[model samples]
Target: MDVLYSLLDVHIQQLNPIIQDKTFTNTLNFILTTSTDDIVSITTPILDRFCINILPTIDHNIKSLILESKSMERILLAADYPSLTKLKLFNFKDNIVSYYFTDESSFRRIFREQITDLILIYDKNNDITVQREYRNGIHEYIMKFFHNLKYLSINGPSSHLILDDSSPTTCFSSILTKLCVYVYCFQDCLTLLDGRLKQLTTFIVEIDHSEPSSIAHNMNNLPNLTTFSIEYRCNTTEFDIQVLPLLRRMSNLEELTLIIYNENRTRLVDGTYIHNQILLHLQRLYKFNFYIRTCTDLNNVTYSLSSDNIQQTFTNIGYRHVKCILYNITRMVICHAFSLPFISNHLEYLGNTFPSIVFTRVTKLLVFDILPFEHEFFIRLARFFPFLKDLSVMNLHPQLCKSDSVNYDHNQQYPVIEYPYLDSLHLEDSYIDYVEQFINETKIRLPRLKILEVDYRKLNTITKQFTRDVTRLNCAKVHRLIMEKQVVFPKTFYVYFPLLESASSYSYYFKK
Candidate 1:
């Protein structure tokens, strides 16, 4: 009903003035004035019509306006938006930016006092000179006119621009609470924040170089800062030296996210000593996220274990609290040497060097990015993690399902391995037959399992068949099945399994 009314509102606005009635105008006015409503987008033609024909009567009713750069000036000048307080500008060009900041511009007269939240977006072009100019002009424009501006976002090429014009003595009226900008302008932004935005509580910055030490030094100035994020791209050695020490000073930080890139994969294999040192200082920290990426040679690489004597190399060190998902052989060796507790790797890798001390405490596990092996390999892997609750496996071979030569009934004679606490399972890019075989043959029932997510884009024609088979299974414990693709079940199937239908109290649908 709301969608229908909104559609009617759009069509009525498009009608000719002679055809527009009082009821239509009233409905349009109600939509414009409603503070709870969001006017998401407005095209050039609609904006022009509103400014020329309708705005004169309902100018004071509008609370927010989102305009494109092309029509921003014309729209602002059409009427005096007395109640407007929020404005967002898109595709803002260099010339238009400069024009609006000038003293003579009519836009400054109407919106300068009321607009507290402002957003400016520019095209990300390869031309460095144009970007620099736009950044300088836009920064100057904001500082001059929008003295009361509280929330501001300047995205794109402005990150590379250095604000040489801003001085330490300049005072700004706005007390910015949140800021997102690039590393190049970080120092200048701090200079601006020194006296102006002293109350800022959140800061998100992107670092593209190896100067994390300098960034850390600047962060001390933001004493009131509670949330800090650093998206760093550099080598692992540099991160260890420059980035780790920086974490020690952020005592007031409540949440932290570090996205680190490693050019040298060998450096991370040493263990979590550096990470542990950093974690020790964050006493007030409640949320901590660490993401690492390393360069890999995709063309010529073999994941096969070289020796059976690998288990003799591990020494039980005190680095048991660290948990990680290792990608290759070097990382696996590194984890073993450090005695890291949790691991997510291939069945082949685990079979060759299964460490008892490390596997006993692992609660989360993922077997990903490996060649397919038999179902027996998975059964062996599950035995290692006694407290395992979450499991995600990808790319298993389909032969495990069709291997009738080996009797699973004999395998079932062994004690059934049940993960009592395992509530969530995710399988991606695997054969449907293998999945069915694992569920049926293993006879492993997760009584506490509530969520099951599967990705079957690899199975095209038999996707629905797989869905049907899963729904018909004895999965009484499962409540929600989240699939990558949508599935439709037959009405008779739902009718026959009325208890399953009652158990799942909601309709199954794709989550966008």
Candidate 2:
């Protein structure tokens, strides 16, 4: 019975952790069966054993179930969970709503009667925006379907559940106390605060686009809301107009996190501006974490502003560990500022000019520059960001001192540039040399690399149409591969990438 404590909150993947490690592996059956007429071709003997031999023995004690779309029904039928109250669904889409949430389903009664917390991971949104999954259908239904839904989280950037004035009141949830989801438009964030979900106390939203939103004139302060966080990926120039008004409404918030990305010279989200405009207003706020990257074009600026100008702004502010760096390339100044130890697990647009600091916490890093990423830079990166798990190299320019060329002439040489823990690498927007730097076994080693995103052109050029043995070690380990160009599944591709299960074509976008 002591083992039942761990089983109180059951994640289906726990039974088959090795097999269902990747995103493609977990939802592979669901993607295949739903997209085509094929049944689930994959077998799960462990899951069968859990259901047949284990679940019935401890069903009454189970309080939570986190499941995926394909085997959720089988797992539910195997047990009558008397104490189940929390349900987190992965790979949840519009097509499966009827399969699980409707009256036709056997577990529908238990879902509506027992579940109070629901987390729907749409599973496709790796970036900020995704379109393949359900946008509004599943969200609108769950608000009414769950009789006691207190905490509702819809993961993914496109899970924007927006309702206009014509929307029915049934879509509104008075029982919901915490809501974390994405919004399509800036107005949708405002729409959430428009007397809907009257009991929502903690709100975390990611606004994909900052379009022109009609400002709510008499917006009431969110007194009940103690937690409010936003990640506005507005590449457009509307951060000031669209974001500031929304923050003013959360005057009573206790915890606040703002990760805003945009380009602006004058209207910067620097420490001084944040202190004067934001922190001063939120009197109840005790905790705040922020990562604000605002690019400034010095071409049109009348006055000069260096990294010193921005870093000095944090001197008076209470934020002691805040670091600011301005990467000046040509006429464009990339202002990257954040409160350390790293706000999120990711950092972007970093270059050779970045300050020497140990970012032990940042697991995902994006290195963007027109200048060639030299071998020394990689050595420096491996030393500073020791635990980088996912790395994105976005340089169209090739490396000057290529990995093979490094220490060819000089006696002083850098140690092997090894990312021992890196699981994913993205060279989709980079050159063939970078592909060589990481994949070529002689150059560097990525022991845990499983996912590779590259351009077909560079990949083909480097690996010589997937015939090179130099990259076979990494290509063999990569389970999922993403190429900018559509790839023909030639025998060579398969020969090179033996462990490949998923390969898709995608275009990687960087800021203008």
Compared with the true structure, all predictions reach lDDT values of: 0.50, 0.72
Any runs in candidate 2 off by more than 4 Å, and if so which? 1-60, 125-135, 162-170, 213-218, 235-237, 299-308, 355-364, 383-390, 396-413, 420-424, 428-432, 447-461, 464-468, 477-506, 510-512
**Best lDDT among the predictions, by candidate number:** 2
TM-score of each: 0.48, 0.79
lDDT of 1 by residue, 1-512 (tens): 12222343366666434333443432232112112122323555665567666666555666666666666767678878777767767665567656776667776655567777776665433344443455444554565577666666666544343555455434344466666655453345444445566776776666545532243223454467688776665564666655565566567879876655555444332233433566567778776554444443433234442222222222122333433433454333322222242222211223223344436654555554444545555566667776666666655546434433123333443344466666656654455644544344244556566556654343222233334343334344556555665556555534433434223222232110
Per-candidate clashes come to 0, 0
lDDT of 2 by residue, 1-512 (tens): 22332342367646543332232121112222332122332247656665776577656656777676677888889978877888777766666777678877898878888989888876552343435444453577887888989999987534666544424363588789998887766677777777777888999887766666445533777778999888877654577666777788877889988887876545455778888888888888999888889876766555677777788888778677788887777777788888777766668889887778888888888998878988788888988899888888988887776434322322324566688878778888777778878877666778778789887877776777787775677778888898766767667988898888888886543321
C-alpha lDDT (0 to 100) for residue 242 of candidate 1: 56
RMSD of each: 15.2, 7.4
Q: Against the hidden true structure, what lDDT does model 2 obtain? A: 0.72
Instruction: Give residue 103's lDDT in candidate 2 (0 to 100).
Output: 79
